[model samples]
Structure formats: C-alpha cells, structure tokens
Target: MGKLKGEYIILQNEQFYLKGYKDFANERLKIEDYRGNIEHIFSTIRKLQKEDYVHKTIVKCRTKSVPSFLGQGYMLEGCIPGYFLGGDAYFLCKYHDQKRFTSSMWVEEDKQLEEVWKKDGDIENKGVITPSIRKATTLDAKKLATFYASVFPIYPVPIDNPDYVKDQMEENTIFYCIETDGQIIAAASAEINMAYRNAEITDCATLSSHRKGGYMYDIIQSLENELVSKGIFCSYSIARALSFGMNAVLHKSGYSYQGRLKNNCYIYDKIEDMNVWSKDLSALSAGKSALSAGN
Candidate 1:
C-alpha cells in the first residue's frame, strides 16, 4: 500500500490529500480495485462540481508512476476524456517480451460518450418498440445488472448480483428497463471517469423481445443528442469484434475507427478484440443519416 498525491481537498473529512501512488500487487487496494474508495473521492468531487470545478485539470499516477501496477490516472475536467487526457485511466501489465519494461507498462485509454444532436426533436415512439424507454430509477439495478450479464460476458466485481448493480446505479453508473409488456429487458449507462473528462457507454443491452425494435438505437440517439447539446462531441467506446450489430450502430451514428487493441477483451466464449471507435460531431456530414451503414 502506497499513497496518492494531488491538490485534492476532501470536503467531507475537511482534509487535503497530496498526490502519490498506491501499490496493490501485494494486496488488494480496497474491497475492489482502488475505485471502491469512490465514496471518498466523490465527497470532494461533489463539492467541486457545485463550485464549478469542472474547469480544473489535475494529473495523477499510480504508485511508482511508470513501471507500476495500475499505471497512472490523470484528471482534467474540462477537456474530452481519453484523447485529451489519454493516460488518465489505465492498467499496467508486464509483457513477457524482453524489450518490455521490467516492472510493467500502463495501458489505458479514456473513453467517453459525447452527445451529438437531437433528430428533429424527440419522437414519441421509435419503431416497433418492445421495452419502453424510460429514465432508470434506483430500484431497477438488480434487473439491469442481470441484463448486462446476459447480453455481454463482462463479469463485474460481483458478477450477476443485484446488489452490485444497485451499487452501480447509486453511483449513476447504471440505467435499467424492461419490455413494454413488463418483461425485464434493456439497460444502459455511462461509466464516467471524471478524473479524465471522459465517460464510456457501458452495460448497454436490449433483451430478445426488444431486439430489432430500434429501442437501443433510440435510447443511444437520445443520449447522444443530449450530450451534443451540452457541447460534448467526442467519445470512445470498445466493441467486441463479433458484435457486428454494435459496431454497425456506431458507424450509422458517425463514429470512426481510430484503431484496435489486439486481443485485449474477454467476451462470452473467448477473448475478444476490442475495437475502438470515435464519434466526431464537429464534422457530421449534412443529410448523412447512416455513415457506417453506407460504408
């Protein structure tokens, strides 16, 4: 266990913390990864947000900085995540190759959801909607978590436990839903790394009943529109190579393929390739409805 340093003022404890690093290889940082301490982090951030600290930018690193366990994490509030604060959130890994660093190298790219624009105002209904689109309340966490576990093979720290989903929902990291007929279904949410001014769209799913009904598309489009109106035009998301449908959605919405992290993701039956895609609202071709579709 090491330490972290920065000009962080913990509002709840009435204390100030200096930036440093913490080592977890020999021990578990918290109940989970260091992120479990988010309650403490949010205490100060919540106050900062109230005071408009969104403009402040701070660089931080894992213990040992370079050649460390979790690598380094930086925080710059105003700029877009991932690109601007490219090294903000990452995990370090030791490559067996002789040329690799002795300890390890940090590898993480901040990805965020950038809201694009409203399509001629919201339509009361999207085509063949099965699960109704609604804002997820705290109560829906259990179903939401289960939906994500079913759709994609990502096992959270708690896997399919509803309590874990509830925890995530409480942290604004989850949204939930079900079919219009009341059958449990779709879930979506933003996994925000506030330290990097970036957020990733995670746990997005639509159950079989809601499939092909355009519910997921509509919900994502709405979120994008909201972000675009707020001036957040760039975001990054990773999709499994086999998830052609997900990739197709990003393409239709105007996301470009920046690059890929070879064989770096775990999907249901195998280790999957992570496809990195970026959406640039600054240059949406006029009258272009489906950029990825035509290409």
Candidate 2:
C-alpha cells in the first residue's frame, strides 16, 4: 500500500524459515536468504500473499529445494548457476494474480535477445574508445547516486539516495565506475553474497553521452575481475525484458539466458518484466575465466 515495507522473517525453534520482505510499490513478496523447511515457507507465502494482495511471490532457494518448491505450484523463473557453494541456486515463483504473471512483451523480448546473441559476443568489439575503469569507494556514492538518477527516474531500491548507496558500499556491494575528467560517466556494482560464493553483476549504467563506447562492457568486466578475486564462482544479472541494450550486454558477457520474471519491479516509470542471465564462474584452475568463451 506504500513505497516499501519492513523486512520480515520466520524463525521457529531456533531455525530460519523465511527471510524476505513485502514490496509495496512492486506489489510482491521477495524471499531470499532463507534456510528452513519447505512447508513452513509455503505456509508463510500463502498467508502473506492474500494479506498483502501481492501480485507475485518469488523464492530463491538452493538446488536441493527445487523439487519441493515446484511441487507447491511454483514454477522455475530462473537459476543462478553454482550460486550456493558450487551447488546451483534456483528462483521459484508463484503468482497470486494470473494477469501479472503473464508478460505481454514476451514475443518482442525473445526477438531482441536472439538478435543480440547473433550479432556479437566479443568483449573486444568496441565501437568507441573507453576511458579507464576503476573500483568505486564510499567517496563516490553521492555522484554515483546522481548518475543513477539521471538514468532511472524510479528504481526498485533506493539507489538514488546517496546515504543508501554509501550504506550499500559499507556492506557487501562493491561498485565500479568510469570517470571522464573527474566526472563519473559509467558505473556498475557486484553484490557479493560471500556465504554462497555468488555475486550479482548489476546496477549497470552509462551516461547518454557515452553509450556506444563499450564503457558498460569494460566496466562490468572490471567488476567480474574483482568478484573472481574474492572467490565468487557464480554471477548473474536480471535485466529489463524490453531493454535491447541491457540484454545485449548480458549476452556479450557470456551470460546465458535462464528464464524471465514477469512484472517483477518498478523501473524507470512503471512495472516491467525482467529476463534472467547467469554465468558459472569457475576458478582459474584451467588458466582462463570460465566466461572467457564470450571474449
């Protein structure tokens, strides 16, 4: 009924059941970082779905729980390969509102994804010269927030808040950016879940003035290097279903399309569908990045 709500979790007998929150603006319940019995989680999902009038419900669980979740009428929305300590993580979704679960843009989105994959997947295929890419610190949060504001009029999270951005930096989010003459031009972040040995390569953006220069690819590649150094083996991204540029970058980075989440979040101006892309980042035991095929 509002912008956002408090995060809640279910703990029983000193065990974790469900850990996530209700998103009021997005009209959904998000369950992530949960460890408990499947029955408890399903009960909570039912209770909350009707209580909140949520359009959709999503649960991100590990490989072992996939069959159980799917048995509860939850469908596979996507998979984060090797996300849980070398085991895979799965995103299972249930829709309270059938209309919200179906995407009108599915046909068009499929066309764009295939088009990008055919054109190129080379990291070195640059159209313009890119500036140096570097890791961002807390000092850059304000400008980074400003940069995000310029790109997205509204985002699912409080990414436009400088304080929130700073808080994320102090936490597990590592940001990367490209500066042009001391001004932040392009940026991205690696949201690390050290417990699971996974990272989410997201928050990617480039200035309108710098779009075709391969800035995004270079910036994300730099973030990947940092994530690899931190021992992350799985990396994934959820891009807008309708955004040709976003989907193209994911394809070019060697990430394979897993599935799509429908009516997932509010981005730019309204509710939008999201396409999931994932990559299993293997350790450099073979002397090359697991994602090196795209390069």
Candidate 3:
C-alpha cells in the first residue's frame, strides 16, 4: 500500500485498489478533512477493487490521528487510516515499528485455518455466573475504568480514562459486567459496527481472584447473545496472541482462528501481535437455535 497526494492504493498480485478522499466521498472530503465517513469511503473502494479481481480482500492501515473511536479502541496514530474492505471485514492495522512512511501492506494470510468446537445451545446456559452478569450503565464508567486499569496494563491508552469508554457508550457499544456481592469483579463489552454487520468483543478482564472460574466464558456467551439479538451475526477481536486463557475461551466458544497480524499492537513499549480472531455468530446462533428446537 502507498499513499501520495493525499490518496492511498493497495496492490496485490498485479491487481490494485485505489481511491482518493475526493472520489471516495464524491469530493465531500478534502485531503485534510477531519470528518471522513470511513465506512462509506471504503465501500466505494471495495466496489472498484472487485471490478478487477474476485479473490478475498484484505487491507491494512497504519496512520496517525485516526478517529477518536478507532484510536481508543485500536490504537491507530500519526494520520487517519485508509479503509480496507471485502474479505471477512475491515481492520485498521498498527505497524510493528515506526518506518519513514506511516503505512505498509500485507496479504490476508489467516483465512486458511478451520475452527474447532462448534458449540450447542447448552453451552450458553452452562456459563455459571458466579459474579452475576449485568449490563453496564453510564453510571458505571468509573468502576469500569478502575477494572480496566487493574487488569489491562498492556492497553495502549491510559487505563484510567473513564471518558475513553464513556465516549464509546453510544448505541454502537454495549458494556457489561460480572459482579460479586455488588463489587464489580469482571467486565466485557461488545462494540457493534452496524454498518459492517459485525461486533467487536473488547475490554474483557476479570479480577485475578476471579480467574479460572469460567466467568469470562460465561460473559462472552452472554454478550454474544446480546449482539445476536440486535442482528449482529459476525464478531471479531484483537487480543494478545499468546494469552492462553483467552485463546482457550474463544476456542471453546467456536470462534474461528484467523491468525495473527504480527507485531501489530503495544503492550507497554514492547510490541505484540494482536491476534485477529473472528467468529460467525450467525452460524453459532443458528446452530444453537436448531439444537434448542430439537431438544
């Protein structure tokens, strides 16, 4: 991928997708415009790219000063990112290190792996909520911030910014908790990209004492169902590639392994692969529904 004159292009196997902010937004956004509707902008590029090739598509973005929403969630920087579309979903990639250019490109490699543990509906109920699960309200921001601070020391943004999550509390995101005797012990949230028809599972953390008790798994399933009810059928997450406990939970829950974007994020100055994992939640819901009907 390369950017020049305030536009970006990606070349793969002699086929390419390119767009300018002008053409992308029909001249609505100038080069330095701040309010780019990244979703619509990428959809236009994907349309043109498909005109040339039929293979699965992947686009990676490295930039500074991404939209606050993307920045807080994914840690994009320096410039606003260009859009990637048409494969499974769009992702903004954080480069492993700083190069002279703000961005680079990579092929989509993870589509090769098959997933394991297709769960039955019973798996949903099997989640014993020792610390009961509940939807988080705006009032819970401070508590949520505190929980994140204690657990996600590796996150790129300061963990204490209650406003960070506060800004994400619009219709797009649903934050929730696993609480014990009224003290919040664990937390998770799903951000639904209504435009993309998908959900991003993020901010999952449990108190150390609460670990190994399956609360996280229970919370994940519950949140998955919540997204499903709202018509989101696909879910994806970026997590530390080597987090065995999280990987095991996602694995058991039937999320497909889509491989890692090597050295894509920060864990306190040390970079790590933010493993890209996705699940076809629609399939999971359908399978569970069928199993339920049979029972």
- Using lDDT as the measure, which candidate wins? 2
Arrange candidates by lDDT, highest first: which order?
2, 3, 1
TM-score of each: 0.53, 0.90, 0.60
Counted clashes in each candidate structure: 15, 0, 7
| Model 2 per-residue lDDT tens digits across residues 71-146 | 8888888887777787777889888886887788889888987887886746543456677788899999899988
lDDT per prediction?
0.44, 0.80, 0.55
RMSD of 1: 12.5
How does model 1 score by TM-score? 0.53
| Candidate 1 per-residue lDDT over residues 17-122, each given as its tens digit | 4332222221111111133244465344334334321322222323323233222232111212244335323322322223211212113222222221222233
Q: How much is the lDDT of residue 241 in candidate 1?
A: 46
lDDT of 3 at 183: 78
List where candidate 1 sits over 4 angstroms from the true fold. Answer: 1-82, 85-94, 97-131, 153-159, 172-178, 226-232, 281-295
Model 3 TM-score relative to the real fold: 0.60
After TM-score superposition, the amount by which residue 140's alpha carbon in candidate 2 deviates from its true location, in angstroms, is 0.8
For 1-295, candidate 3 gives per-residue lDDT tens digits of 1111123433232233333232221111212112245554444444543431212122334233345336434432112111212233334432222431132322222221222233323323335546568898878888888877777655644445777677778667898898877778888889876655767787778788768677777889889989878877778776665565666667776665665654444453354545666777767778878999999
